[model samples]
Target chain A: MKSVVVNNISKRYGSKKAVTTALRGISFEVDKGELFGIIGPDGAGKTSLFRILTTLLLAEEGTATVDGLDVVKAYKAIRQRVGYMPGRFSLYQDLTVKENLDFFATIFNTSVEENYDLIKDIYSQIEPFKDRKAGKLSGGMKQKLALSCALIHRPSVLFLDEPTTGVDAVSRKEFWEMLRKLKEQQITILVSTPYMDEASLCDKVALIQSGKILSIDTPEGVVRSFGKKIIAVKSSNMLNLLADLKKTELLEDAYPFGEYHHAVLKNESNEHELKNYLQQKGYPFEIKGTDPNIEDCFMALMKN
Target chain B: MRTLKFLLQKEFRQIFRDPSILRIIFIMPVIQLIVLPWAADYEIKNIKLAVIDHDRSDYSRSLTNKITASGYFILTDYTSSFEQTLGEIEHDKADIILEIPASFEKDLVKESESKLFMAVNAINGVKAGLGSSYLRSIIQDYNREVRTEWIQFPRFSPETSIEVTNSNWFNPSMNYKVFMVPGILVLLLTMVGSNLTAINIVKEKEIGTIEQINVTPVKKFHFILGKLIPFWVLGLLVFTIGFGIAWIVYGIYPAGSFLTIYLFAAVYLLAVLGLGLLISTYANNQQQAMLISFFLMMIFVLMGGLYTSIDSMPGWAQAITKANPVSYFIEVIRMVVLKGSGLADIKYQLLTILGFAVLLNGWAVVNYHKRS
Candidate 1:
């Protein structure tokens, strides 16, 4: 069953003469208990779409529903069913960790003990600092507490907007692990992030840019859609390798990978011919055939 | 109802934890109510008098004695000449110089009239005007005394005189502090109610906590009520402190029942607090919220019938007070306190203020959106 569905939703801001479109003809869905990721750069309409799903904002056109309830018509019911963690750390900074939890639980007409089992793994890590004001918590600890509060009410679908954006690598890894555990509990989770490496962790991922969805598929499916032979190459003059490759016009796109550069070839160009051209140019380099990653796929899609 | 309880608990905890609320509510009222009445006093006294008694007659000496006996004037100098008295005024030593001309008793008895000159320093107009008026009344009283003593023909005496006695009802002594105490109490309640709640919601918005709450199942009115109740209770507590200070320091006790004053205050707080909430809804940050709160408070305080009577205000200002919740409370508070007015006497003011409460709070609830 579809746990969340959005259909061609659009939104714009500012006055008549100066309106800027934030989202345009966006449509997607998340199945029951499926961990879905909306991957994009900043200003990709991720926050706008999350707000629409959480019933905190209304779309200018089209419709959205959460758990079989319309986002606009059944907002009050949707609010009770879903939890939203905004792009910012939205907990009361002046409040302590324990107080923030208790407050969210009470508003949902539940007690912390009632749902202690759901958030025990996450909350226990921050339990020692329960008396500390949330404003004083570290970035990683704050995210943990925010997630604990978001889950305290046992929401069926959790909408987390950039939950791991500013977190450290270790905490980001632990947070994803927590989400996987949550998936085991049969909870549907929809998240948005700018981190390309994190995109592979979701059951399904949608590559969005400039308020439009470029593609939506599983991790391997998106990499497969790149559909061109690519090579990772590095040379002594690493800085000039990117500029020299682009001038050849023999490749579709060239981007700097960490230690090397990933280059995709055009349909007519062969790897043997490209190697001969590189040797003749006196640019001694090591090159090997490689599999495409999501970042490469997103760059390829954005070019067209 | 359960949501309100939880929200209110969090609000009260935050409020009490922050020491500023305690200072703004408790210490502020006690200091303002105790010291403001004494500072804002309009009763003019301590006038310095310079008497140039050229006549040196019995009547001139008696007039000077009468002026000093009134306690309004202090005999600062007995100048030998009017020029010396003018010098006294120029140095600010004397406020007025009373010149009893060298007529002896000859002009009043023979010519039936005598002109007395009074040279007054007009720099501080209110003091000078009051001093001159007091001197005139005393001299008139002395005229009546001399007339009755010298011309004691019963049938020929003045029969057309009309005596006008001022009772200055309720406050027969007409103490200005009695007038200011109640108005200052209303002002204290207004400042605490408007500024605090305005900053409360905007602070949440500034820190992004409002986003968390907006995404919840809490109703709009429930959120507003949660914000209002804690401050409402605090406003009442401060008001009680102000009332106690008024009595302890100024000896001003309400002649009317406490219930009547509370009735107006309860509704007045709703109106002012609702206004604060409405301002917070539109403000994007704490600085913007603070500015808007001050903008409204300046209007409310200046036009609230606190410093001046609404009747004496310009026609346009009087029209604006129809919608001003502050004016209604100021009027009702004074009525109940000074005149011992009953509920029936203040029914119109009470009903109008109740309407203002509903209108402003209703606007606040309606305008406060969970979305952009």
Candidate 2:
């Protein structure tokens, strides 16, 4: 059974004349107990889509349901069954860590004892500071507490909007580990992030940009969709290398990727000719064909 | 019911944990209740009198003595030059200048009537009005003394005056504190109940916690109740403290039973808190909530007839007071505290406030949407 089903969902902001289209015919589905991700940059309708699925916002067109319940009509029942952590820190700052968790538990008419086993892995990390106010916690600790609170009710479907946006690198890895552990408990998780690297951690990701989805597939499947050779090239002057590569009619696109510029060659451009042309320009460089990652695919999709 | 209990628990925890809220709850009552009543005394006194005694005669001296002895005028300056006394008025050394013209004794003895010129600095209109009236009454008393001394026994005076003896019932001493304490209590209740609940929900909105709560299974009715009950109880707690202060400090124990006051306060709190929640629904942040609350509270308190009389207000203002919930509570509190009015006497006001409670909370609940 599908945990979430969104069909042709569209939303617009502002008045009639100066309308900003935030979502355009957004449609997707999350299978039961699957870890789903809506991957995009900022203002790519990621938050708007999350809000629509969580029933906090209404779409101008189409329908969405969580756990087989209509987001609009059965919002009350959906609210009871789904846990949503908004993009921003939404817990009471003045409340202590344990108090925050207990408060959310009580709000859902549950007890901490009932859901302790489910959140023990995440909650145990910050359980030592249970008495400290939530606002005083470090960013990672705050995220852990928020996750614990979001999971306190043992929600059937969990929606986390940019859960790791401001977290440190280590904490972001640990948060993903926590999500992977949660997937084992049969709780379907729908998470959003602007970090392209986190896309592979999700069971499946929908690459979205400018209020539209470019593609929805597994990590490797998205890279496979690139379906073109990418030559990673680097020289002493990496700055001019990108500009030089883009100037060539032989390449589809070239962007800086760490120490090397990942250049996708046109179908007609031969790798040997490209290397020869660069050598004749008196620019000594190293070039090699490389595998595309999610970021590369995202960049390629965004270009199209 | 269980959800409401948890909600109240969280709200009260937040309230007690914040030092600023504690200060507002405790410190404000101490300052407003203890200091305001004494400072807001309306009984006009200490009129600075600059006397221009041109006659310098027995009667002028006697009039001056009587005016000074009346305890209303301070007799700031006594001089022969009217120009000098005008300087006294200009310099703010005196409030009223009493010029007794020359031949004052001779004219009064021969013609039995004489005119006296009194000039008052009209700035600070209340003081000027009250000071001049006080001086006028004292002069009239001096004239009565002069006539009684001059007339023989059993002789008919030329003028017959109708004497109006006044009786200030309920508050026989006309103590300003006694009248003010009850009104201040009502104001205290309003400030605590409305301002706290007004900012409570908006604080959640600003912190982004309201979105979390909205996504929960918590019903709108329960959420609003949870926000309201803690503050409502706190409002009544403040009221009790204010009432105790009124009794211990001002010696003002209400003539009516305490139950009547609480019963009215219970309904009054619901109305004001409902108003606060209604404002919270419209406001997106604490600043907006505070600004809107301040605006409505200003209108409510001013027109509620605390500082001024509703009857004295113009027709439009009086019409506003009729709609103002604060006015009803102020009127009800005064009735119960001063007049010993029972629940039956104030049932009309109680019902009107109940109507306000129903309307405002209903409108708030209707406007408060779980999704937008």
Candidate 3:
């Protein structure tokens, strides 16, 4: 069963064409118990789309339904069925973690004791500081508290918007692990993030840029479709090597990737030929064939 | 109902845990309730008198003594010339001037009546009016004393049957403290209730928790009601504490039923909380919420007749008071506390507050955008 369906959603701001067409005709669906990811950079309409699906915002030109209920007409019902953790840590900072959880539970006309099992994994991590004000908690603890609050009512569908954007690497890893545990409970999840690596953990991924969906598929499938022989080159003189590689006769695309330079061949040139050409140009370098990653796929999609 | 109870419990815990906000909520009201009434009095005192007595006779000296002895007027300076006294009055060094005539003693002895020239600054109408009344009363007393002492009896004893009957309905002594304590309590509760809740919700919006709440199954009305319930109870708690303080420290106690007072306070408090929620819906940040709430609170307290009587104000100003929930609350509180009137006497004011509560909360729920 489809847990969520978004069709042709678009949003515009104002004159001076500050008007960013957020979610321009973006359409997608998530099956029950699937961990779906919307991967994009800043201003890619990730938050806007999440807000629309969560019933916090109304899309100018589209229809979205959660649990087969229209997001607009059935917002109240949608609210009951969906759990949302916004990008920012927005729990009551003045209240203790326990108080925040209890308050959220009560708002749903339920009690924390009634929903303890659902939030136990996330809540236990921050239970040591249950009496501490949420504002005084660490970022990771705040994230945990927020997640616990969102899950207190055991909604069938969960929406997490950039949940790990400002968290530490360890916390981010831990958060994704918790999401996996949640997935086992057969709850459909729609998670949005700007981090490309996190895309691989999702069952399916959508690569969005500038409010437009560039590609949507499994992470491995997206990388497989990159269809380019990528080479990583390194030399003592890195800057000159990058400039020289871009000017190379057989080099189709060359950009820095971390500590190495990533390049694609113009017409399927061999490594021996590339090494000989570089030697002739007096640019001593090492070259190695590398498999395309999610970042590489994103770059390839963006370039097209 | 259970949701409201839990939410209210959460709010109370939150408020108590935040030392800064808790301090502001409690300390501010106590200070304002104790100090504001003293600072807001319109009664004038300590007037500086500059007299230019051209007729420096015993009668003139006696009249001057009488003026100085009135306690309201302080004889600051004695001028020889009229110009000097006039300059003193213009410079604000003197409040009033008594000009005794040259034949003042002869006129009083020979003539049945004599007139003394008096000049007073009329810039501040209330002060000027009180000053004139004080001077006239002093002169009248002095004249009566002189007449009785010098002449055994008047040639013609006109049987002037002048009768003066005065009755003060509530607070017979007209103790300003009694009248003020209740009003200040109303003002204090309104300020703390509206400002704290307004800032609380707007802070959530700024921090992004409002979005989190928006996605939950919680109904919008439940969410808003849950948020305001805590502050509403806090307002009542503050009122009760203030009532106790007033009774113990200031010897001011409510003459009406405690239940009536609490009931009216609870209703009025809902209106205040509704106004706060309305403000929070409009404000995007904590700072904006605080500023707007403060502005509205100022207008509410001032127009609510906490400092001045609504009846004494102009018709237009009085008409505007009808829209202010604080005005109704203050009137209800005063009537219940001072006049010992029950719900029947304040039914109109209670209805006005009910209307405000509905109107404000209706606007809040309507204008509150689910998405931004």
- Highest TM-score against the true fold, candidate: 2
Between candidates 2 and 3, the one scoring higher on TM-score is 2
Docking class of 1: medium
Model 3 clash pairs are A79-B217
Q: Write the per-residue lDDT of candidate 2 for residues A275-296, one digit (tens) a residue.
A: 9878877878999989888899
Off by over 4 Å in 1: A233-241, A270-289, B44-160
lDDT of 3 by residue, A1-304 (tens): 7998889888776666566577788999899999999999999999888888887778889888899999889888888878888888888888878878878887887889998888888898899899998999999999999889888889999999999999999999999999999999998989999998899999999999998999989999998888878888899899988888888878778889989999887666866777777787685678898997888888778887
Where does model 3 exceed 4 Å of error? A13-20, A102-124, A235-253, A268-289, B81-92, B97-125, B143-152, B155-167, B369-372
Candidate 1 per-residue lDDT, tens place, B96-186, comes to: 9998889946687778678788889999998888889988998889888877787766775456777697778889889888878999899
Per-candidate DockQ values are 0.65, 0.88, 0.63
Task: Tell me the lDDT of model 3 at B218.
Answer: 53
For candidate 2, the per-residue lDDT at A275 reads 90
Question: What is the TM-score of each predicted model, taking all chains together?
Answer: 0.87, 0.95, 0.88
Who is ahead in lDDT, 2 or 3?
2
Better of 1 and 2 by TM-score: 2
| Rank list by DockQ | 2, 1, 3
Instruction: Give the B-chain TM-score of model 2.
Output: 0.96
**Cα lDDT over the full model 1:** 0.89
In model 2 chain B, which range of ten residues has the least summed lDDT? B152-161
